[model samples]
Target: MADSVRSPRERYREQVRDEVKRHAWEQIASAGVTALSLNAIAKEMGMSGPALYRYFASRDELITALIRDAYRSLADTVRAAAEGGTTAVALAGVIRGWALQDPHRYLLIYGTPVPGYHAPEDITAISDELLAVLLVVCADPAAEDQKSPFDVLLGAKRGWVAKVLASPRTVHRALSFWTRVQGVLSLELAGHFAPMGIDPGLLLAEEVAEL
Candidate 1:
């Protein structure tokens, strides 16, 4: 089915929403999400705080939208790379590029949880979507029989195996790849490597190569 065309008012609203999100990200980058203020944002944009509420019902609603966009962006990035026949290492490189381009956006999803903020179920659903992609990238069509202790454990869980249809080996590799990348990225982005005088990029590249 084709996408329905938007009316002029709808288009304007969408544009403003994007702009609002951009400013929200900047604010979060500087003072953290706990300090995100719709009124402050409004003041900066020269609009009344109540007027902004027309677009977002509450602060939590806006934060939820930001989280959704972050997850969606990462999911789309990985899916595109995988669909283009990229390998795990190459895909990891793409992820690193995405994170480097907007470190705050990357952290917004994976970094420390916002105080007093609990994500909704849709956030978990988007996360599962991302995991499904990793399962796809990890699968080896010719090597179905390979398994490890963890793979055996995962295989016994019929609920998920029945859904993702990935072999234990694929799942193991995918999880290992995910953890390694996350470990490197979280530390690197947190500025832990700067004090050590070691290159985080080379470390990340080496880890990917090992995988």
Candidate 2:
């Protein structure tokens, strides 16, 4: 009977933790980061004030966990997108799809700067992993072909060395694509397009075409 009671208690704890995180996400979506509060979230969950501290040390710790989860989710999305394609554009579209699905979540990582706010090292490391995936996808195959663009930039330079260093160009392309896509997404989420009567889908398509 004691073991059975222990299993149910653990399950209840997990359920409560998940409920709190869900409410926290809802609060974040409705208001900005400044609006997130453990007390409010607990109230929304029908729990007393002190109950949340058992799950999260503080609001900062909860925010940190959410950021980590966000990065991991993005990394997974990009990895799935890269599975069958070697094109940077393909990966860019995957990221765009993700942004469209949850602009609020996207902004949590890329929105307006917060003073004294620093992302945890693990989040940055996951971001690097995503960048590495983009790098691999953007590697130019034409570098080895006879009709390559290296001729314009590597004139009179060591061809082999230039080929080896072309990875930076791929990285630049990936970063540029991400930035452009994010701009459209952020503006759309903030209702910058509704007033102008512009269609964000068309803009997103144009950006993808430019890639």
lDDT of each: 0.85, 0.74
Which window of 10 residues has the lowest lDDT sum in candidate 2? 143-152
Model 1 agreement with the true structure over 1-211: per-residue lDDT tens digits = 2226877788888888888888999999899888999998888888999999999888898899999999898989988888899877888888888888889889989898888788899998988887888888777777677666787888888886667667778878888889988999999899999999998777877897785
> Which regions of candidate 1 are displaced past 4 Å?
1-4, 141-146
Of candidate 1, the 10-residue stretch with the lowest lDDT total is: 1-10
Model 2 stretches astray by more than 4 angstroms: 1-10, 143-166
Model 1: lDDT of residue 194: 90
Error of 1 at 184 (Å): 0.3
Model 1: number of backbone collisions = 0
Clashing pairs in 1: none
Cand. 1 TM to true fold: 0.89
Q: Candidate 2's residue-wise lDDT over 48-91, tens digit each?
A: 78988899878887887778878889999898878876465556
Clashing pairs in 2: none
